[model samples]
Target chain A: MNEVIELLQSHRSIRKFTDQKIPRDLFLELIRAGQSAATSNHVQAYSIIHVRNQANREKIAELAGGQKYIADCSDFLVFCGDMKRPTDSAERAGADVIRGMTEQFLVASVDTALMAQNVVIAAESAGLGICYIGGIRNNPAEISELLKLPEHVFPVFGLCLGYPDQDPNVKPRLPVESILKEDYYREDEAMVDGFDETMRDYYGQRTGGTKDTNWSKQLSPLFNAKLRPHMREFLVKRGFELK
Target chain B: MNEVIELLQSHRSIRKFTDQKIPRDLFLELIRAGQSAATSNHVQAYSIIHVRNQANREKIAELAGGQKYIADCSDFLVFCGDMKRPTDSAERAGADVIRGMTEQFLVASVDTALMAQNVVIAAESAGLGICYIGGIRNNPAEISELLKLPEHVFPVFGLCLGYPDQDPNVKPRLPVESILKEDYYREDEAMVDGFDETMRDYYGQRTGGTKDTNWSKQLSPLFNAKLRPHMREFLVKRGFELK
Candidate 1:
């Protein structure tokens, strides 16, 4: 395998970080790399908010379910799905643009994720550790207000970037057979069963045999309750009406 | 800049491809690299359907706004955002799993995009070309039936991967200052105006001076009318109620 593929395959989310801060130039380069990601119709409907203020970062950390890494990381960034720019630009170009549509939300969200993945890859290549903070969505409204995000824009997720201070084992994934199908959507109970065992072993080993749960069991909280149920209204209030 | 950054910055969507089929092993490796992408809460809620049947691919091409590249590429894949498997597994593992929620939809969508971006990077590193086909959403219900997608599982986008037979110029993006903000969101009308000119030049040069429109003008159709207005109802019908 080549270095790029190897780098991708050896991926792991880093939580703990050292005291080293990224050089300003390198950080800018990482954002440049992010901007290079494939955008649908070249709309580029995304923005990154660098959270530099200590007070704001701490507030964000609390909002994101107490993910202290947001405060501790050398740099924390909130990636937002933006639709205002394109719509406003189109209106300026003489088009009576519609404000909210389902496709617009999908485009902006997917575009943001694609760009952030490129940033993650670039940071890891430079021997930096990074973690995606989806917890930011737990309180999107507060985070948006804290970052002064305008209407037609919403914070999709946060990312923590810094030098590594702790080494975590690469997390296991579902088996290849479970995820890849030939020509149709096929269900393989055997593959799922096999993967559950693998995850069971992984969780046990990772937590020193103290955690006795498989992937499915771990996903209970996410599925058992209404997960961030306010997101629909929040997104609509942020101007992604999903119309 | 390193090879990864270079590879990312040099990305262009390739629609024309050679007839050489990707070896099965290499194809599997690409998917493996995709799985290495960071997923939300280890949900890994995505599936890739490899459409090898010529008839199905042609039909998909028809469904996707006659993008012939769908049928022409060496391999065509439909990337799906799947909440079914996780919810089912979790329910079976003794959780009273809820069916559809907005957060679930967002997580699955973001997870699928992150994984697909990794596949794109891995493919490009191996000298392969890829084009993301969002047009599949034009007939998502038909496409879902064609692929036999279950409830809580929907195709986000299609990908055409193969050896390139055409070299397209890398598309330009908006200026860094416009997309990156320190501490809070900011707007720069001048940056957008400047980028419109850059895009106008790019389109003119790439199309041999036939295309006269700039980026803002090009986005007119997307916003002037209700583009893909059926997507919201479609997602609801597909069990992503966005509730």
Candidate 2:
């Protein structure tokens, strides 16, 4: 396999990072790579903040569900979905601007996400490790306040980057057949059942002993748990009409 | 700059692609990269289908608003938010499988998108160019029927990838300040004004001495006219209870 393929196939989330500061130029290059991603209709409705200050990183780590790895990483970036940029531009251009509910918000979130993922790959290719911190949304208001985000902008996620200090095991995924459908999307019962062994092996690989639980066993509670309740109201409060 | 940074910083959507086939090993690498992306709590709620059959690609292209590039590309991939896999697993485990209209759906969508971006980066790193086809959602019913997508899965987008047959200018993006916030999300009007020259330069460069318009002018109608109407209902029908 080609070098790029090898890199992609071997990618694992690096949680522990060495205290090496990513060079300023490489940091800029990471953002540049992110900016090069495709935006909806080329509107580019996203922005990223490279949080390098130790104090700020510490605060962010606390904000992102007290994850120390966030603060410990050399580079911490917050990706935001922004609508105000274009609206402001339209206002400045003396043109009528009408954006609400659907594409405006969706485009920004998706665009930001795409750009962030590009940063992840680029960082990885640069021999850096990255872990995305979606837990930032757990306290969106605080994140916005900390980042000074405007009403039309909200944090989609945070990314921590640095050289890997520890090598995490490759997390298992559901079978491609379970996820990939051909000419139409259909559920495969057998594929889902087979995913149990993979999940069990993944858990066993993570720890010496198996958890003895399948994917559904681990995830079923999450549906009725704390993660779902606040997300909708949080999005609404962040000014995404979500209509 | 390192090679990876250059690859990312110079990224552009290639709408025109050669008809050569992507190597199977490279395809496997791209899919693995897609699988490597972080999922919401590792639920990994996404899947993709590689459409190599030319006739099927043509039909998808026709269904997706006559974007000939979809059919002409070496490979066309459809990314989907898959809840069925987990739901079916839950059913097998004798747990009540509820597809709530909440964060689960959003997580699935975001997860699918995150994986798609990884695939895009992997493809690009392998010297392939890609164009994301958001037009797939233009007629979701036909795409669903053609792809045999089940109820709990929604087609987020499609991607056309191959060697580039054309070299498009690097699309310009808003300045960092326009989107990035400092402490809290706040809109700095001056920063946006500073970007007008940048936008104008991008427009001029893109048009090659022909007529050109600023970003806002070009994108407003696309949001208001073409995509706004059908997306909400389409999403709802796809088992997203947008309560």
Candidate 3:
């Protein structure tokens, strides 16, 4: 109904970016808006690392499954879920802090995601385009070593931000009825089956008839291959325990 | 900065709300905005439960650590991280889906948070206020059973939305420097100390000098007390396994 809602609805990830870099002031302002997102119990458990070195950016781009936009974008930031800052600070202040609880992991990850989403909205609204690099988790151990992340902090994702050089259609989503339920969780099998048809049409049209996959079939590569099977060991080694 | 940026920076949690209910269409529109957020691999691993029953809301309010606002708000939405639908769909399509990789848990949780944050922005933009209810995790078992949530679906957080009856001052956040680093993970104890001072002043003013606490001291109850220690078992029981 408003410009803000319109902005939210029109969000589409941009991979190709123009050469113009975001001004330092504007970049910092985006972080400010991100910090304004609500944090659980005011823990604010997150850290954003701005990768400025060209070599590091290139390395990360490859580490994140060859996503070249990470190196090409004006700025690439690694958003990390950090329990270290809060728990360490609390301990130093004389509280016998607990560490490595699963709840802590959940809260920190959720806090980081919430903060980053605000950054995305703020960036998109300011005529900047952004892409979330979930592929970074594919090589979390090496990426963390490269960035010198400490114990109790794991990189959740990377974000690439810049002025868009290309325009793409907004990807269609599952209908609202399929995900939103009243009072209790209900089955939405028929709705999902209908969505498969919708996606088939979307992919066909978007790819000029080259791609012939529906949403369900498209998930085969990710689900059947045991995606990111090493993530548990990595997180535990990074002090999450996830217990 | 534009109005969208201003709105993002001006966010504050509203615990007290007016009795006026949001129109049905507007609420659904907010969900639509939420679905527009980026999902990892287009998994769209989330579900929003609209708890419209009066008694259920009251029970949920108590379950979420006695937050009466859950019962009083125009709507209380439990944002659930759902892997069941996606994995099941993939299996039905003939893929041998791996059930509970830790990365699956991370992606689903992140997707849920990103989606809910979008809904929050849309609600705030529409002149409705929201309070995130992180306390629901305190007793997730009872709450999940109450909502009849199936396996592989876990409640991540709740959102209380309505027209504000009280306009609280925007809560101060840690300076961007504290959370935003350059190239590496850096120590920010000094910045955190400075923010403690800022929060001290904010709380003093907000509570008319009745509460005397800094951010560090305020974290004692949560960290020192081993907040939500049962979450690991609860999540495992709910099929997250987090393995």
Candidate 4:
């Protein structure tokens, strides 16, 4: 693999960070790199809220199930799936704008994800560490309210960026054959079993035998519970309609 | 900017592709790079369908609204947002698996986008070109059926990959101030207005002065109509209930 492919492969989410602040210029460059991602139909349906307010960060930390990094990181950003700008631009051009279509919701989320990943890769390449906080989905309505998100805008996730205080090994992934199929969708149960063993060994060694579970075993809690059941109504209220 | 950031920003959707195929080893490396992307709770909820069959590729080309690149590209991949493997593994492990939460839908879509973007970057870095065909959402059901995609899996988008047959200019983006906000969500109408002029020149020059469109005007058709209104029901049929 080339340097770019190697960089892409060597990604690990950073949780602990040093007190070093990212310079304003480099931060802006990361955002520009994000904006360069391929967007759907060139409709850049995403926004990032740079949460610099300490009080707001603490509240968001509690709202996201006590994720203290949201408050402690050098900079925290709320990545939002936003259709308002594009739709509003269309309306201003005198087109009869139809909002809240399901595809709009899907496209906005995908666009945000693509742009955010570019930001992540760029951040990693710049010797800064970053972690994506999916915990924001834990309280989307409150997070959106805190961010003052308007119609056709929803908080998709948050990110904590800073210089690393701790380093973690890159977690292994499913074998390529498991996810990449030729011509049709298929299952790879054997691959999962093998990956579970790999994860078990990694977790045990990483935590010095404290974290005992494998990947398959760990997923039980996630699927056994109806995670984020409130998100549907919350998104609809935020004008995603999703219908 | 460093080499990685430069590569990230240099991205352009390459529609025309040369006949040279990507070597199998490099192709697998691309998939491996995709696997390195972050997944929610380690639930890698996505799959890539390598469309090797010419007939299926042609049908997908038509199903994706006459996107001939699906057939002409050396490799065309259907990136699907798949929740089956994770949830099914959970169920097999004897969890009373709850399925079809809206958050699951959001996570799967985001996960797929992140992984696919990594693949895009890796491909580009390897001197291959790529295009994301969002038009696949137009007839997702037909395309899904053709690909034999099972329950809890949905085609999010398609990718066309090959050596470049055309060299297109890197598209300019909305100014950083427009999307990168401070503490709260805000509209950047003024910045967007400035970007429109930039795009006007890009589109005209890229098409030899034949094309006439700016960023805002280009978004009119996408928002003026309820794009892909059938997606909700189709997703429901595919077992994404999104509830």
Error of 3 at A173 (Å): 0.5
Instruction: In angstroms, give how far residue B81 of model 1 lies from its true place.
Output: 0.4
Worst 10 residues of 4 chain B by lDDT: B167-176
Candidate 3 residues A1-243, lDDT tens each? 888899999999999999999999999989999999999999999999999999999999999989999999999999999999999888878999888888899999999999999999999999999999999998999999999999999999999999999999999999999999999999999999999999999999989999998999988778898778899999999998887
For residues B97-131, what per-residue lDDT tens digits would candidate 4 score against the true structure? 99988899999999999999999999999999999
Which lDDT tens digits does candidate 1 get at residues A174-233?
889899999999886678788889998998887899999888899998898999998999
Interface RMSD per candidate (angstroms):
0.8, 2.5, 0.8, 0.8
Ranking by lDDT: 3, 1, 4, 2
Q: Please write out the lDDT profile of model 3 over residues B1-243, one tens digit for every residue.
A: 888889999999999999999999999999999999999999999999999999999999999889999999999999999999999999889998888778888989999999999999999999999999998998999999999999999999999999999988888898889899999999999998998899889889989999998999888778897679889889888877776
- Residue-pair clash count for candidate 4: 0
Angstrom error of the Cα, residue B130, model 3: value is 0.1
How would the candidate models be sorted by DockQ, starting from the highest? 4, 1, 3, 2
Q: So what's the TM-score on candidate 3?
A: 0.99
Top of the candidates by DockQ: 4
Give the runs in model 4 whose Cα sits over 4 Å from its true position. B207-212
True contacts kept of each: 0.83, 0.51, 0.82, 0.89
Select the stronger candidate by lDDT from 1 and 4.
1
Give per-candidate clash totals. Answer: 0, 17, 0, 0
Task: Tell me each candidate's TM-score.
Answer: 0.99, 0.92, 0.99, 0.98
